[model samples]
Target: MDLSNIDLSKFDGLAFIWLDIETITGTGVYDTLSSPDTWFVHKNPDVCEDFICSDLKNKQIFLITSGSLGHKIIKSIHHLPQLHSVYIYCQDIARHTPLASEFKKIRSVCNKTQSLISQLAIDVAHICVNIGDQHSRLNKHKQALVWYERAFEKIKQHNGLTKNEFVNALKSKINISTLECQRFQQHRQQLGEGMNEVKYQHELLRQLLDVPTPLSSTEKDDKHIAATIKKIDEWERKNIQQIKTVAERVRQQLQKQINEINKVNKVKHDFRLINDELRQRQSEDDYVEADLQQWLERLQQLKHQLETTTISDTSQIDVQITDDIDWSSMVKLVESDVSKTWVRTREISMVESL
Candidate 1:
């Protein structure tokens, strides 16, 4: 008799157990008929009497019987732990009875368990791949590499993956990191030498001063022009000195600012790279908080520059009105023909009177 020949569905919500009786031949099967109370004794006579006398507590038992006693066994089968267990035991009973139906049922359950295990393995591997891919996409190359390596290791350790799968995943991560490293290097190289803001401003101012303005005709006056030229020379000399002094001060200030900015930028770049690495290893919220603090400090320094630098109205040369005009008037004397004619007529009248 094959124990695996029983149908589990027949006992879907029912419970039953097997009773093995051994003879000198080591195998014996018999059929019996009895009531529910009597069937318990026939199935487990030694334990049934004690079991009925005792409280039974929370304990459950199943009793399977053949022929006429089967109904009684079925009645007490409800106390069994579960229907599945009862059905399993029933199949064992069928071993002595030997049937084709029972074996088919056991095969079905085995197939179901195998399917579940296969699906679980696939799901676990897929989850690992997704986690690795997400980290990789986040620009955290090192961290992504770590996740990929870990996933590959986990896949190999638990999922029984082939060596090729592990190697492929590792190579993919390495390739991503190599590309990212190259890109970062290129970006750094492109930043090159920065502009000097103070020197640029001074050069621009010098060009403005070098531009020539046309001189007016009135400016060519001897005395007025001499005084004007002296004043212009003095003003140029003074302003030139002032411009030089201011240029030096501004140059120093700009150099200082550039140095500070460079220092801060270097620190910021290092911190940013560190943060990028950390983000791969940590959570997004943590990285954002740290980055914000660095930005805030930089913003405060920019604000201080804005507050300290004073904007002034530009001074322009004002050509004095007196310098633009000559005040002295010149008059030219002319002899008129009417005055000469009148003098001649007066002389003729005086001669006629004589």
Candidate 2:
């Protein structure tokens, strides 16, 4: 029987069997009828019945089939695979069917979807790190740290593996984060130390400014003050270079510390994210890591500058107050009875004397 072109839909509620036979008889005829109609004869009806029963049992062995003939003709069919679950089928009357192509497509789609999800997770980590770095630049240390920790946590989360793998990955991330945090703290301590040194230098400058000039016994105090001011000018000129050196060192140290902390944090964060992407089977881009390394090199240069700067003390000032006044006249005026009477007769003086 040529059944390839047959529309199974036409057989609705009827049971039929198709058979092809190559016989070497004079003609393919039986019971004085054509070959096609011969299988319906009473004596050969079992031949048709047996083929129908065997094929139907084999096809219905599972829960269902979607072939149009099954839907139209089946009344109480049992053990058929659901039609929706049957994606593809290729059957041979004499051999077992294989489903290589269908499963391949399913696996490909699943993998692609997983890759997309992992990529999205990595991108989020990148944005968080960038924002954190920016905040650090603005001197918002607490906010920056918060964002950085969040980025680190997100990357760690993406290490989406089973318990054993997750535990190992989490331990690694914790170690790295701890090290990075400590390094930043050290930099901050250095910056604070440099600021303290600058403050010490400033206090020294204040002391120099406060120093009094030696006064002659007969010179007015104003003359002594003027002489001291002149000495202070000379000291300022001599010490200006040293003060500038100290100020520069402090500025460079602060900048270096800030840059170092930022660079180290960025490297730790990027490394974590890269590791996570690899584990999750996502793409890795090295641009961010390269930028962080560049920042580290720049900070190193600043540190060098800070280390090389030198501070020197300013030269001391010298001044002379002349002793040219008449001491006798001043002393007589101070001891005169008119001056003494005015001193004793004033109300303010009486209050002080009482």
Q: Which parts of model 1 are misplaced by more than 4 Å?
A: 1-121, 163-170, 178-354
Question: In lDDT terms, which candidate is top?
Answer: 1
Which 10 consecutive positions of candidate 2 have the poorest summed lDDT? 345-354
Tens-digit lDDT track for model 2 on 1-354? 011221222321112121223222332222111111222211232453344455443221111111222222232221232110111111231121123132221111112323423433343344445555555566555555655565455455553532554335434544555566677789999999999999999997776445343643235445645765665555556567765887788778666656755665565566566556555543444346766576567656655654554422223222233576443432221122222221321111110100
Candidate 2 lDDT (Cα, whole model)?
0.39
- Please provide, for model 1 over 1-354, each residue's C-alpha lDDT reduced to its tens digit, 9 standing for 90 to 100: 112212222322111234424211211111111111122223553454345335332322333333223333333433333312222222234342232143222211112323323333333344334445655566656555654554455445444555576457666775777687678667656653223555687787766444333643234335444765565566557767975997788778656666665655565676676656666746644456766676667656655664555433224222232453221221112233323321321111110100
